[model samples]
Target: MIVQFKDVKDLTSSPAKSEKIHVYKSGENKGKTRKLNAKPARTGILPVSEKTVWTWVREGKFPKPFKMNGRTVWRLSDVETWIAEQESKATILKEGA
Candidate 1:
């Protein structure tokens, strides 16, 4: 028989600091806090560190982030597409192996 287990530390870890609570300052939901859905490109959507994200960008492995209102950001669609492509590639490699 064979069994698999995830790292206990990983299971017990809290959400990353990148996941932040956003407070509505002036909208109808003013004073209400919501989990931020969009994260800055510097922090990256993946579990990787900020430096890794920049390194990927420099290496041309990741999409380039753009400045919007002086804040750097990546398009959600682009990020989603990149993730899908990575998944497909992984599937291909697994099948080939």
Candidate 2:
């Protein structure tokens, strides 16, 4: 069977449990994978300042951002994964120490 979505809402609304939802910008990359700017990136699940984020990126501790029309953006998934890894590492360290 084939299904057709009439609008963005339709597409965003009922994803399967195993499916991953991707939020994207409205312009050229609309409906594609989402990208977060410095501000949003800093305000994510594990909040951190842009400066710290950049420092971590430079030190190979965080995900790198890609250029989007002269603007730098980090993939939301990548940020989430980084946060998860950090939490996992912290848990391991706490357990060990």
Best by lDDT: 1
Q: Candidate 1 clashing pairs?
A: none
- Model 2: per-residue Cα lDDT at residue 81: 74
Off by over 4 Å in 1: 1-44
User: Any runs in candidate 2 off by more than 4 Å, and if so which?
Assistant: 1-44
lDDT of 2 at 37: 33
Error of 1 at 45 (Å): 3.1
In model 2, pairs of residues that clash are: none
For all candidates, the clash counts are 0, 0
lDDT string for model 2 (1-97, tens) is 4432121121122312333457776988787884343221112344444456667879998767777676666666666677788889999999999
Q: Compared with the true structure, what per-residue lDDT tens digits does model 1 show for residues 2-87?
A: 33222212212234447778899997999999996653333224766556667888999987877767667676667667778999
Minimum summed lDDT over a 10-residue window in model 1 is located at 4-13
User: What lDDT does the true structure give each of the candidates?
Assistant: 0.64, 0.55
Error of 1 at 49 (Å): 0.7
